[model samples]
Structure formats: structure tokens, C-alpha cells
Target: MRRVVLRGFSTEGGPRPDRTALLSLGLVVLFAPLAALSLLPLLWPLRLAGVPLSLGYTVWACSAGLYGLRPVQLALARLLWPVRRPTAAERERLDLVWSRVLRRAAVSERRFRIWVVDLADVNAHCVGRDLICVTTGALAELGDRELAGVLAHELGHHLRMHTAAAAFLVWVLLPLQALALLGSGLALPFARLGRHLRRTERGFGARRWALIAAGRLEAGLRLAFAAPGVVAFAVKNAAGREAEYQVDAYAVDLGFGAELLSALRWFEACAAPAAVAPLVPGPRRARHAAAREARPTHPPLERRMAAIIARLDAAPAAVPPQGRGRGRSESSRTLLP
Candidate 1:
């Protein structure tokens, strides 16, 4: 068995970028120009203020979380997403768990920030490289050890730079994603308009037909151009499944395998009844059309649990979390305040 190191920690040299991280970055490079098109409007105001700008630099800056703009990133996440700074009670609970996690990982508390996402589901996620968002439900629902496992899993993503690559990737694709959203929003309205015009014109107008043909041709061409990037994104998401397993391994290495395993079982218990509960009568396809077992970025639950169990079973008895206490290594504390 490979000996575990708490300080650096990982599959290899101290959680460097893996294949998933690189692929996310590769997609960013491929889509940078197209994404730049979406940022022009936002930058126009700055240009009016005589700020020097280049599309290349602006694209890079945004993808890199605008470099030194951590405050802006946090603010945008609060405004646009279901996240916020933790309240006193939430922070008290959150920090207690986080201190243990940080203590185990041998990392400074100041390096990472945690946020509370006001959600009911027992869940959490890593955003970019520095932010960890935990759902309020998770705080209320999980025990301290269970919550630590979740945090450790997310911290693994940061250690490997997975979140860094992913956040920037999403930002890079924002323009295309926004366009896709816009098209869907306009689709029904345009269809209604077309039907209305068809009814008024008694169904045959050369100009209308010409307009429809032009629109279809333009849409087809755009789709054709977008196909490659879409394929790349799918590949990146596929890579994300492997990352889930890798971080699971990280949690295990930190002696939180049992804790993480318990957390997973807790989730399974909560979700079991819902998975099998009766739904409205419908065709099999229709009933399952909207249901999903897991996200594209996660491995199946059974597989993740199995992986964690195997790691825990194989872990050496001398490992801190296995048979030893948190004080197994005094070195972990040497770096802490």
C-alpha cells in the first residue's frame, strides 16, 4: 500500500492539475474568441471611460476570475446564485467543521473561504479555487464528521485545481450558454408570432416563407459551427465523473473515508423513498424523461460508496483516521496557529 502524506496529499505530487483540469482549460482556449463576443457590450462602457482594453486580455481576465477581483466574484455569486455569507449561527457550525478539516489537511484557514447556500438538500460544492459553498440543509442535516467529509472532498478539487479550471470554463462559455438560453426563450414567442401571421395571411406569403428559410439557414450554420465546442464540453463533463472519484480518494486519504462513507449513506437513506415512490401514471419514457440518477459531473452513488469503502478497508491501521486519533501526527499542528 502507498503511504499517505497529509501535508501535500494526492494521487501524485501534491494535487497538481490532472487530465480533467487540463481539458477544462483546453475548452476555455477553444471558445475564448466566441466568448469574447459576449463581453464586448459590458466592456463598451469602460472603453467610453477611456480604459484600454483588448479582447484577448479581457477574455483571459474574466476566465481567471478577473485576477484580483475576488470581491466581485463573491458579490456576483451572492447576487446571481443561491449563496451568501453565513450568518452567525451558520458560521459557528461551519467554522467548527472547517477547522477540523483544515487541521487535518494541514492547510491554513485563510487560504479558503466557505459560504452558505440556502438550500434544503444536503449538499455542497467547490467554486473556483478558493470558495466552498455548503447548503444550509447540509449544515442542519449532517453531523460534524459527515460535513467534514463533504468539505474534504471539495478541498480535494481545489488541491487538484479542478474547481479553478471548471469555474473559468463556465465563465468562458457564458456567451454561448446565454445565447442558447436566449434562443429557447424566444422560440415559443416566435412560433406564436408565426402562427398568428399564418392565420392572418391565410397561410401563403412569399416574403414570410423567405424569412423563415433565411432564419433556418442561419440557425443551421450556427449549430454546425457550435457542434465541435459542444462535443468538447461533453468530453469535459465526462472527465468530471473521474474527478468525483479522485476527490473521494482525497477524503479517504485524510482519514475521513469512514466519515465520507457515512455521509453518502445518509444521502442514500434520504433519497431512497423518493426514488421508488409512485408518480403520476404515464408512459415509461415520459415518467423518466425529467428524472436523473446523478449529474453529468458525478459518478453513480453506488460506485462512489464502493470506492470509499474499498479505500477504507485497505487503509493501514496506523493511519490517523483509521485506527489512530487526530493527534497521530503532531506535524499537522506545527504549521497551524
Candidate 2:
């Protein structure tokens, strides 16, 4: 039942750090390119028709196109994820929490539509421009403040257009994934052939040498096809880690740093031990395990917590005013007037 208080480091009365400036920088770097890419398919016809579009015009067209897809994306999300409508009691709680969060963040209440899934995992994510999905386990486990923190973290993703960016990037990377799949398919026959040769080769003679050569050929082919995708995957995950940090900073700016940190700790505790276990005893085993853990799409929880704490320490203490319904009695601040 301990509370985490964020302390400010500025003592000289220097100018407060600009949250707007930071948000703007994140938008330009993280959202702009993805917005442009999402527009590309829609604008292709204009370029094909020889409309002579400028770069600025093209970007405008793309933004419009991406905006148009929001409804369709929301529909697809509902179909794929299949969340149930909130019951009367659940709806009341959701409305209270969401309204307070929107008021605190100064965002329009209509901008986001919240969905609760029947999943058991304590997870939540922003699906599209407006769709915020949370698992039932999250609702059951998190207090009102913790739930608000989780929502704020997801809201950060929405505000920065990270979901759109991710969707666009996935489209861009589809071909690379396909190539990797194709390579695996192609290598399967060669691998089978090598295995067959090894099985038929009865002794250490010409047949054994031929079997070794076949195995080598199979390995080479697999590497040739899989290497590009392997590199791309690594790069994509690296970018994803940075994006996670950016959104964490956004949540802290929303005055939910302590809650989010606590939520993350809960997640770490819930995760399987092997998922976060230290490297194995041997030197090589430990080294390889370390590399595998480092390759995940999000940075490790310890690193993320450290980064958020550092950012909070440097951030101005009074940027976002605390919301009215942030305590155990938050349900009293319902949207029902």
C-alpha cells in the first residue's frame, strides 16, 4: 500500500521543461512518417493519373486517407478481438474512469471508444485511432488509479499515433516477412534431401562426404533467404523499444508515473519466471540468454522503470493537474451528474 511520489530536480527556478515541445517532437518523429505511408496507397491513383502533386499535397492526401480508415479499422478490431459490451455496472465504472481521464488529459471524451475483452491476462492496448482495448484481468486486478494509469499509457500511444505508425510499418515489412517465409519453404526440400542422404549413407565413405556437402548446401540456402528478414526484425524491435520509452514519458507527463510504474511491477511479478530468469550457469548459455531477452520488442521492465523514473525526476512537478476521481472513492465521481 506504498505510494510512489515523483520528485522534481529543479532547485534554481529555471524555466519549466516544455511538455508541449516534447510531445511535438515525438509526433514529428514517430507519427509523421507512418501517417505519410498510410496515405501512400490512397494517393497512388492521383500520381498514376498525372495530377502532379507536391510533397505537401501528397502528405495532406495521405492524412485524409488514413483518417478515412479509422472506422474500418475499428470495425475490423471488433470483429477480430470480439469484445463484449459492458454491462450496466461495468459501463458505469468505465464511464467514470474514462471521463475523469479525458478531463485530466484535456482530451475529448468522444475521441476514444473503450472495449473490455474477456481475456485473463492483465494487458491493454490501443487498436486504432479510437479503439482502446483492455483485458478483464486488468479490470479485476487494477485499482481505479492503476487502471487510469494503464489507460493513460495507452492514451499516450493513441495521442502519438503509435498504432497507426505500427500498422503502416507492418504493411511496409510484409514483403520482407513473405520473403523469409518463402526462403524457409525453399530450404525445407534441401534440408529433407540432406537428411535423406545422411540416412542412406551407411559408412564413412563417398556417400558420407556427399551427405555432408548436402547439409552444407541446405544451411547456406537457409541463411541466404532468412538473413534479410532477421536483420529487419532486429531493427524493427529496436525502434519499438524507443517508441515504448516515448509513450512512457507521455504517461508520466499525464501525472500517472507512479501508477504506471506500479502496474509494470505487477506485470513483472505475474510474468513466468523463465521469461525473466537470469541466464543459465554456463558462460555461453548465459550470454545467449541475455541476447535473446534483449531482443524483445519492449525493453526489459527494469530498464523501462529506470527510464521513466529518470524522466519524471527531470520533468516539472505541476504540468498536469491531478484528476478529481483518483482515489479509492473514485466511483463517487461518476459521469451521471
Across 162-229, the per-residue lDDT of candidate 1 in tens digits comes to: 87787677666666655544454545455555566555653557757855765575566556545544
Estimate, for each residue in 1-337, the C-alpha lDDT of model 2 and write its tens digit: 2222322221222122233324333434554454445445445678888865476455554643563376676665666565666777667887887776677677878777888777666667767567787777777766676677778777766776666555555444444455556667777887887788877888899888888877887788777766654665565555555556666776777777766765665555554433443211111111010011343455666677666667667442322322223253244322111
Off by over 4 Å in 1: 1-15, 33-68, 178-222, 225-229, 272-292, 314-337
Error of 1 at 80 (Å): 3.6
Error of 1 at 112 (Å): 1.3
RMSD of 1: 10.0
Please report how far candidate 2 places residue 285 from its true position, in Å.
27
Measured with C-alpha atoms, the lDDT of residue 124 in candidate 2 is: 78
Q: List the residue pairs that clash in candidate 2.
A: 39-62
**Global lDDT for candidate 2?**
0.58
